[model samples]
Target: MRTRHVHPRPADPTSTSRRTMFVVLLLCVALGSVLAPGLEPANAIGRTSPAATLPSQDDGSSITWSVRPSPTDADPERPNFGYDIAPGVTVTDSIRVRNYSEETLRLDLYASDAITTSTGALDLLPAGEEPTGVGAWISLDSSELAIAPLEFVDVDFTLTVPADAEPGDHTGGIVTSHRTPGVDDGGDTVILDRRLGNRVHVRVDGPLRPALQISDAEVSYTGSFNPVGTGSMHVTYTVTNTGNVRLGAEQTVTTNGRLFFPGRTVTPEPMGELLPGNSLTFDVDVGEVWPIGRTTATIELTPIPTRDGDVFDADTPVESASVTAPTMPWTLLASLAVLVGVAVLWRRHRRRRERREAALVDAAVREALADTPNASDGSDGSDGSEQDGSEHDEPQHENGDRDRAPDGTGAGVGGAHRSGERRGPPAPRGNEQ
Candidate 1:
């Protein structure tokens, strides 16, 4: 009875075809899994990676630093970075920095633009070495300080409260770096950067400090390392007093050393105790500004009836600069030439001395060779003497590093002595009559 139904089941070719198709599809998926990583992402299949999308930290740029204060004035101990300063005042702030890189880097500190170009010292600092801790620069100081790798240091900056400094927040930043710094990304060019800036809110009460005025403060030749009569900048301060008491105050100013101005000490004068409504205006010279791009100082002020150091506090910063004064090629070349000359001269001198010593040994060795082969008495004394001579062999000189012979003559020893000694015993000296 079951035989009739069994004979009806024919070969299902459609089912076999479907099974084969599924197996082929599975193989393709498995192959893709192995090769997918080598293939580009959907969006990047035909294009190159965008530079913006890539990291460009220390690829080739130098490392720079922009130390910022705690954003506020709960503590005004930072150099030139303080709180509300009166129109007639100055303040000082300090910053700490380090080169968190493998190679050595230099750190330079500077201030930048204020309300007006003339408002703060905008001296240009020359490329110099990095610093470790608190350091100062001025228009008159050498631009050759340096900061070693993996080392940190402090830098002091001053904030100037112009006798007529504008009332309200004046903002700027301190920039530090090397002419050739190693970027954070371990690049070839200078790229390391640290920036710390704050907002300066100056309030000037017409009576305490007034005049919405401006004054020119000049810091002159500060140190012994200037080009005689060079390196000086004219700074203008904005004065504003929006307080109740006739305000007497202190302020700190900062600038770029070497290129801007440095040696930042500030001086503030009283606009007199206003009857809480009257205002005063004037200008006081801070100190010498280094030839940096930024310069600043701190000065203390006492209103008609004020106390010492308890004066108002704030900072006057000259924020930024246009790419106007690029360092001259000749200047850079000159510096390079000097460095090369020093290095070359030192090397040449060393080579010259080495040659002279080598020649003396060559001559001595030749003589020893001839004597050793024939002499029958190869005694211990002779051997000891030769050893002593070898130990003492050096470029002989008479009191100085200049190459010389046993005699005081400044000459190389490879050739025969000019005295016609014929490379033999420094001619036996004859007792003169």
Candidate 2:
């Protein structure tokens, strides 16, 4: 079987500031010494003590230290301990613990099973916690050590895999701890146990099944108030390492709709190494997305080996999950509602005004028709216009009869002489007759 090892970076002494910190371990009647939340032991020995977190002595002296895999002739720059051992096999290794303080220090050394914190950082089980895996298989050369100031110790240990050890990866760490007396804010005394350790990965020869699962996939949309503007989509899901081997993943999030609206793809940050049974959640946002009523979000994960040279099928199928959500433009709908209401009101007002104008014209025409005299009622000659015409015609015919002579021939030039003779002498009338 081929073997592979992952190398980690060294601890930086100046990574943290120099502040006097303390971890107060509570003494329980049944639990003995129980560690607090922040004081939880870590597995990555690369965590160097910032003199600030270490307890100081009466003389203002503090102990600063670090631990890592012991350097060997074959691999002088070895950062952490890694091994590919078979079941029932025995392997021997060593760790180097260095004290950077001016005072001599006494420390306790032990091994613990590896655990990952809630934030995905690698940690180790507390010293008070029992180990059921590789941590129990290894035996340290010495559990206690007294090192001089600025000096280092190379502690050797042997690991014997159980005859029936399960095949796959088993992780743990070798930690160095030092306890000192400290005063709490209440003027009470407490013991501060400072720890530093390097991670150990032991992979037993066996069938490696690298798998991942995506669950609780969900999508939500935030729509814009602007009718023509686009909205944003939020996608959240959890990724779980369901296989025995440590694995990493590359994720691709895609969002699409029913319409030909172009789909959007988002590639979030790469995920860190995930140990078996460990899970991590991711939240991603896709902006500038038009609300097409309904949208589908799909997540695709491609598995990656944390350690190089670790062979698995290259054609492993990609794990995928999908969820759909409604993306309705409620703001736009409200705007449309307001516009429709105004249009309806305007239409009603226009109809009312038109009805009022038609009513006024009808009233004016009725008044004009009532005030005018009825020409159709002429049965009674009491009509003033016809009475006046009859009176004038009668006077004209009587005058014409009085002015004419007895004989129609006596009219004309003799008419004037006959009228003068009747008023004056008979002689003038004889010539007229």
Candidate 3:
């Protein structure tokens, strides 16, 4: 040591132990500052937590949380927050989030559009999907939030319907999610996210059309050979929602004769929910006694209101379609065939009877002609006077008989005598001269 005043070795300011102590104090202070506010008794928060519960990844314990519309909000049902707004208008709403867990929790908040699943159940879009409808129109005050143990927070959001927004029911949700730390599964770190939300039903006021159409109505009949027997009938049709609003349908399929007389009525299962531009094909099997011949199959569709607080009216518009199908009556066809065959047989019998009667008449005429006396025979004069009279009429009678008989001996005899007259009886040149 220098004999002159040796200042005590200044305490080493850069020592490793001192630096370590400083870092530890800093960490303790930071942790205390973060946890001190939440450590105060839960009752000091002055808000009631929701009854909803969520399961945690650590030890399978449960965490209770909920998102609901603020108490003063319109249509403040817990999970369904509905609003009726006009186009080119802006509306503000708040949702209350509650945490009942013993430890503080952080949540990621977002807005997403609602969708119907393939099974026709309502659901929300997955994270990272681009929002297009109601989700795009919403803006939140806070995108992230932290809640103390047994504490609740209310989040305010603004919804701005564009001037071109479609006039109908648009659905979306306000979602809050908690992402758990990554876990090693199959050499891959998988992070699980749990989410809860309140559904937002926004109805933009404008002209709303409610319409339904029944199309492609077809009826097929498979008939038995026996016309009186029952057969199978199938009716197929398509139901389309052509309007901008959702609708449910009560369908009635009927079969009627010319004057709409009741034949068969079949009421299938109600058409549940039909969204805009959606179509459904239905096939119904109806069994009844279908009258033989043409019948009309008519489909009548009455729309059932799907929205809440709707009044039923008797004059509701109904859509109808019809198709004509023919049922063949084999019995009538067979009877017609039988009648045709009887007529043919009766015609043949009548012709045979006429031919037999003509043959008998011809035979009787020929016998009467053979029994007549021949007035040209030279015989005794006992009946000379009568014979003379008969001979005198015989020539005239022979000419008449020849004209009547197409083939007879009288015509041949008359022809020979005419030839003799032409030769003047051979001029009597025989030895009789």
Candidate 4:
């Protein structure tokens, strides 16, 4: 058997850049929910479901055909076609298309350029779109095939590199597809095209530059209500492969609060591979970050060489980007303020209560004195007896005076002197001059 190679599409840089921007926007909107308490990273927003599988029949039957890279002598189990050719050189490859249905099938074979989807997965351009890169370089031996049931056909193709082809990676795919008549939900007739393919990676030998860049970095914090509690620091950024060589990377997110107090350091799983000129958006949440007024987050991407399509050397310097945002502990401050207010209110209440109690005690004492008749009269028991004796003595004197004659020193004068003696010298007058 002759050696055969199957090619897969490579990443399209322009499309990848656009998709990266879109991903950044999406991540920004979903960031709050991602950092919400008690949520898992897997449940983060912006995640998309898997692409729907193309139907193989009008009646919604299972796929009855398949296409993939075929085995070859150079590398029998090679997954896809990979090549390192110099300028003005040509290569050969093959793809196997199998028909597993009960009847024979007709298929159309073609090549298309590769592009990165918005979800960061690889996909091919739609049919009828002209490819300008590896897809245009590849030419298949036959464009149509008729295979019997349970049989497969090996289609050959030629990949010719132009004499002036740029010395880097070029990617495309070898695919087989079929068209079927279908009706849309709007009762309109449509053509349903389903395709399957293998990828091709071609590299022209030349000087390789492997570089990575970090862009649009953003940092935000979500704090807890507890004064001493820890919060989450979210870091988001876009990573772009700006060099000509395919590579991988080691991603790390480091955070620091005021005075360089380390919050959290996150070293996520390393990136396995990244196509040249492609971009990827990353979202990382570092937990247990204490809000210390402000926090700075740094995203560092270290290039890692990939050995899938061609020999790679990622000796470039590490790329880093940073962002800063205020992380004030508002909830904690509010709690402290409430406590202070409560203390002040309690102090005022206590002082008012003490003053009220003092006034009440003073009034009670006044009431007790009023209830006693001699409390402020300044007279004792001896004074009351003296007054009673004086009244009796006065009556006796009057009787004696009446019995005495009307002489110059009669009884009346004697009675007046006796009464004056009993009264104790007329009791010094209160108004005496």
Candidate 5:
């Protein structure tokens, strides 16, 4: 057997291990690139996330950055850019971005529309969503910029109001952001965007009709069984901004009825701000009220021009709404039921007493009738002694025959028999024949 000298094949280094190491190194580099940008202070981005004033400062280990509106901006102390503009007009403004950091910094500029959050606070539009309001009208001079350390740049922008813009307040913002490439430990790449913005408030001037309407008026009552106890009354109404200007309302709710004479007043929660065509519903609770019968609840609203600080005319009519609801008198109803029951029982007792008295009278009358003498019986109107004397005086006959007494009266048969028996010895001979 020619066993060829089997030269031991040097164990080839497993390619799997080398490949694993290479993948890990690549992942580490990518992760570092992704996370390195976040190492900076969050304040590097200004405080304009939600209606922040300008001159916002950010301090780093060896750097400071700031973003703000130019000094020439109106109402610099406020967080927003306020302007009274007319349709078909164009306005110009500027923003300043300063890099005090030791290293160069890059920034991206953008404009976005303002939107009201679910909690009623205002905020900038989300990324990737195109703006349709004032943001659509703004044009930035440059979208990208790079600044050397300790340097600053002013970016100019223009706002052109369309002729058909709605006559109301339009809000938007100018934003600056720094984006960096980042890779996570899982090897996923992402762009980290750190952004900040300054608010812009523009009012399109036109026919500013300030009007409010009250609608959907409702009244509810919670009753108590205690006649004198207090109950609860709730009144709800909706306040709609029916005009072109924003407004706040001073609301008063009044209830008048038997439960509350004169009237009961309730103050609802303050309606902070209402934009055009917006509506807010209010619920007013009035406790410790004695409600009875019908109650009329009225809501009155006094409009206050707050958005533009305009003076509301004193002659403006108050917006009012009313609703009526019937209240049940449980206590009164229970008392009436008790009274009715008592009346029915009393009536029944009276009837029973009358029936008993009538029955007794009938029994007494029957007894009297039974004891009365019969007038048809033949009897002389004389005492019993007279009748006996007449009968005894009548003569008796020897043959036991009695003569006819006057007035066609004769002794009863029994009396004749008794007289015959007492005359002994058959008429005693001398009285015969």
Candidate 6:
């Protein structure tokens, strides 16, 4: 067996070496691909991650990049532009640019020019571009940037919103340029082609803010201070949202030279929010003023947003309503009028009693005078008395002496019946008529 195998082994040819060489060549190619500096990862489908992980363009050999934003279209649910600010507010945000390439690349950050490629977003038909005097152009930023390959770089910015600024929509962008440094002048070297990207939409915003301002500095009420120097009144304040976006607000109400409602320390401080073009209302209480007089007052208003939202505000003074204090004159006058009426009535009652007593005295005097007239009729000359007698009395005749004698004892005793007569007092007679 050994002898037969030895003859076969001698015939070993170069074919085996040829096959080994081919296998070694294949292995070298595979290893070269794995170690290549320019090799890149495969691309993914769709926008599934926060920022698409892509290669950076250095010399434009095989680097890749994309222009991305949080949203590709204007979201009706969330508008692209707006601001929400309250008095004393500051807004802050962060921007991230992620590199997914195998090599380092330079990135230039700037304010994006308002533009899209001709085939990108040029609107037409019903969705055509609006007639804006402003055209879409590139914007430049003074910020600096350099990102390491496969690294995430973060940038931050802040917007200081004024308390008195009107709430509304504001739009802006952040652009990035991928190109070689010191090589941008007309392509001096074999530099990468100009690769530009942008965040087309950015908004400086706050929450829906609502504010309330009283036309009056303070409201009137049955406030503290028992027996207030002046009367009190209450105030109701209504706030209107005049901004294009919602606003979140907080507020405080106070009074100067006046007391708060209920008690000085009991003034209410309200906090809330309001939608855009909406209004809010509140009430305030103020104590009375001095002099029991009427007056007007103005209120100072300061409103601010709690979050990023739109709002409108004027730090100037705003007038509310006419204020009036209680007066003592009318009340005192009413009491005085009542007292005067009582006095007049008492005086009239006293005069009526006096007139009644005078009438009674006059009636008594007339009776006494009538009795004296009878006495005068009896005492006066007979003729005067008889003529002045009442109409009911009979007239005296010439036989008066005979009638008188008939009552006497001697002459006509037989003819005359016993009858008695009494003499009366004389009546008043005219003097030597």
Best by lDDT: 2
Q: Which stretches of candidate 2 lie over 4 Å from their true place?
A: 1-55, 181-192, 379-433
- As for TM-score, the candidate ahead, 1 or 4, is 4
1 versus 5: better lDDT goes to = 5
Each prediction's Cα lDDT score? 0.37, 0.72, 0.65, 0.67, 0.66, 0.39
Q: What would the TM-scores of all predictions be? A: 0.24, 0.75, 0.51, 0.66, 0.57, 0.29
Instruction: Summarize candidate 1's per-residue lDDT along 1-433 as a digit string, tens digits.
Output: 0011111223234423545445433443343343322231111100111111111232332232223442235655433332555665556554445444334455444543222122222111222323211112112122223555445455545655556544433333344433212322222233222222222223342333221222334333233233332243333444444444324334434344453323544444334322222233345443444334334443333323332243433342222211112212343456679899999999999999999999999999998987764445565344333421222224433443534457877654444334423343333223333
Instruction: List model 2 lDDT by residue over 16-65, tens digit each.
Output: 22432222122211122243433433434443322223535534445666
Cα error of candidate 1 at position 235, Å: 40
lDDT of 3 at 165: 88
Candidate 6 on 238-349: residue-level lDDT in tens?
Answer: 6554554334344444333424422222244543444344455666554443323333333334555534433356652332333443423344456679899999999999
lDDT of 3: 0.65
Better of 4 and 5 by lDDT: 4
Rank ordering of all candidates by lDDT, starting from the highest: 2, 4, 5, 3, 6, 1
> Please, what are the lDDT tens digits per residue for candidate 4 over residues 1-433?
2322233234334423545445433443343233333221211111111111223433433335666676677677666777889988998877777665545678778887766554556667766678888889999988988877556788888999989988777777776766555443445444555566677888888887888888888888899978878888888888888888767888888887556455678998786466677888888999988788988888888887766444444456899888998888888899989999999999999999999999999999999987878744645544544432243333233223333334654443224344434433221223323
CA lDDT for candidate 4:
0.67
Give the TM-score comparing model 3 with the true structure, all chains together. Answer: 0.51
Point out the higher-scoring one by lDDT: 3 or 6: 3
Model 3 pairs in collision? none
Least well predicted 10-residue stretch by lDDT in candidate 6: 1-10
Clashing pairs in 4: 5-94, 7-199, 7-200, 8-172, 8-199, 8-200, 9-172, 10-171
RMSD of 6: 25.9
